[model samples]
Target: MSPKIHFISGLPRSGSTLLAALLRQNPRFHASMSTPVGSLVNRMLEAMSEDNEYSVFISPEQKRAMISGIFSAYYQPQAEKAVIFDTNRLWCSKLSLIKELFPGAKVICCVRNVAWIMDSIERLVRKNSFDVSQLFNNPTERATVYTRTEALSQGGRLVGFAYNALKEAFYSEESERLLLVDYDLLAQNPEKVLSLFYQFLEEEPFQHDFENVQYDEPEFDNRLNLKGLHKVRSKVELQQRQTILPPDLFIQFNGLSFWTTPSNSLANLIVAQPK
Candidate 1:
């Protein structure tokens, strides 16, 4: 049976992990910590592109089945009734294919202030002085946080690629298929946020124990020298203080949340029309 599948994507350090952790509370749902399915899809498409040797033999419909088969193959272990959420930043950029392949599938995009996103990553690097994160391929010598942040937010880096991809999808006609999940709302008012998200997915709500949700992949993070990167507290709570990033760095992306600003077409478009 082809299982119901959705997607999780958006900016880095924007609470995707936390959302996944909370969603796993429902036994019928299957969520992974940044799986490589999206990358594989892209590579398969590359292999069948016009420049590839197999381009002549591969039909469009065959390509579709091949890509879809990847999902079916990898997630075959889950119960046929389970709902799957494939996490990947590149999903946003691939919305056209996703819409074509999955029909009514929706994407849950996690979002937060860009500055704070950078700050969170920088804090990770600073807190673990001797190690650099896989965010930059785990370099041996540590770079200045400012330098690192700049490099990461520039083109082709984690933040930049996801940021650009999200903007493209947010502006696309398929925008209705995307639900934006704010980091603050998630941490501060989880039940409400989750309720809204569940409603979007049209699934009956399941009782979630806010006090005891468990999720962690420290072993995975340690490989990146970003130990505890996906660690979530037993309890979800919002921070009561300002970020530790320097004001200049923090302000760089503070007021740039286009999705929340009322006048911004992108912000208002999501709600003005029903999906």
Candidate 2:
């Protein structure tokens, strides 16, 4: 039998990579940074869509099987593991399709304040110093923190798409299968968060070493010219620091943490206490 599949998704710079690193410590689990399976599944859907010349020859059941086969084959090497946690930001947006394919699957969404998320990205851009990021189209878009954040927050862009997709799943009819894990909460108290996380999945708990966690994708980061983009510290704890974003720019995203509004969230959430 194939291992149970769950997903790690949500905002960038939000701890999904760290969560994956911690989860993989479990002998029965397999987890990692973003995998190619998500993109492959999307491409498969496009190929089977009406735009394809042979779409008339494909049936819905066949298409489903083909898509399902992607996961089974991609994780075949880890077939011995009892569970697999696939990481991808786009998964939140496709909750309906996810449910259709894996009815028991759950999505663990790692979230943080939008302002901090922008700050984290800006920090990365400044840290690389010499390399230009492919995240933006051209030099004009990367000219300033304001321009960069603006470009990133466009409805179709990176941060914006994930935020919107999270909101979509947060309030969708399938929200029950989702769990929103705050980045601060995970960083500060991973054990507590993992307890809630396991309860949400109804899976038995496995002890995770919060102090010695490890995960990094240097090649992937270098490819984007965003070094340390997916690096996790050897220890799990929040670092105290002031924002590099200009005051005005940081404040622009003040009220975007919609998950804080209890009335708007239907999914289970594990968040930090208000300061």
Candidate 3:
């Protein structure tokens, strides 16, 4: 039988990596950083769309089965696990498809302040001064913090694309399938967060050691010249830091965390209480 499938999504530079690291601690569960399965699913759909001249020969049932097989094929080795959490930022934009593929599947979105997301990416760029990130196309886009931040926040870029997709999911009809977990809350009080997380997934809780948690993708990071991009610290504790971004630029994302407000959508959200 196929493993119980779920998804991990939300903004970049958030705690998706940490969340996956924690989830994988459960022997019955399989989780990891972003996977190519999402990309493969999209490509498969495109191949069967009107853009392909022969798509008329493919029926809806065939398309659905083929798309569903994408996940099964990629994770055939992990079928023994009771659950599998596929990580991909684009999953946030594809909630409808997820509903059709795995009706019971839920998506956990790891989110943080939009300003902090930008700050985190900026810090990574500065840390790897010797290499140009594939996130940008040319030297001009990586010239300065202003250019870099602006380029990344463009609709099609990494941060912006994820952010927009997350917003779309937040308000979508399938919003109930989403659970937004704030990074700060997850780091500062992991056990509490995990308890609630398990409750949401209706799974038996496993003892996750916050201190010894470990996960990283050095090869993937190296390929993008963004080393440590998905690296999770051994300890799961919130690190307090001042903004590395300019005041004006930082303030631009002031109210972008729409999940903080309960009045907006039906999605469940676990956020830190305001001071």
Which of 1 and 3 is ahead in lDDT?
A: 3
Give each model's clash number: 0, 0, 0
| lDDT per model vs. reference | 0.81, 0.92, 0.92
Report model 1's TM-score to 2 decimal places: 0.92
Candidate 2 Cα misplacement greater than 4 A, ranges:
273-275
Better of 1 and 3 by TM-score: 3
Give the per-residue lDDT digits (tens) of candidate 2, residues 165-220. Answer: 99899989999888999999899888999998988998999889989988999999
> Could you tell me how far off, in angstroms, the CA of residue 167 lies in candidate 2 after the best superposition?
0.7
Assess candidate 2 and give its lDDT. 0.92
- Assess every candidate by TM-score: 0.92, 0.98, 0.98
User: Candidate 3 at residue 274, lDDT?
Assistant: 49
Query: What pairs collide in candidate 1?
Result: none
Ranking by lDDT: 3, 2, 1
How much RMSD separates candidate 3 from the native structure?
1.0
Candidate 1 lDDT tens digits, 1-275: 56799999988998898888888889889886799899899999998899887699998899999999898888888746569998999999998999889998888889887888887887787777787566774442245666777778776888889999888888888888889888877888888888888888999998888788688998888988887788888888988766877788787867656666543323222221111
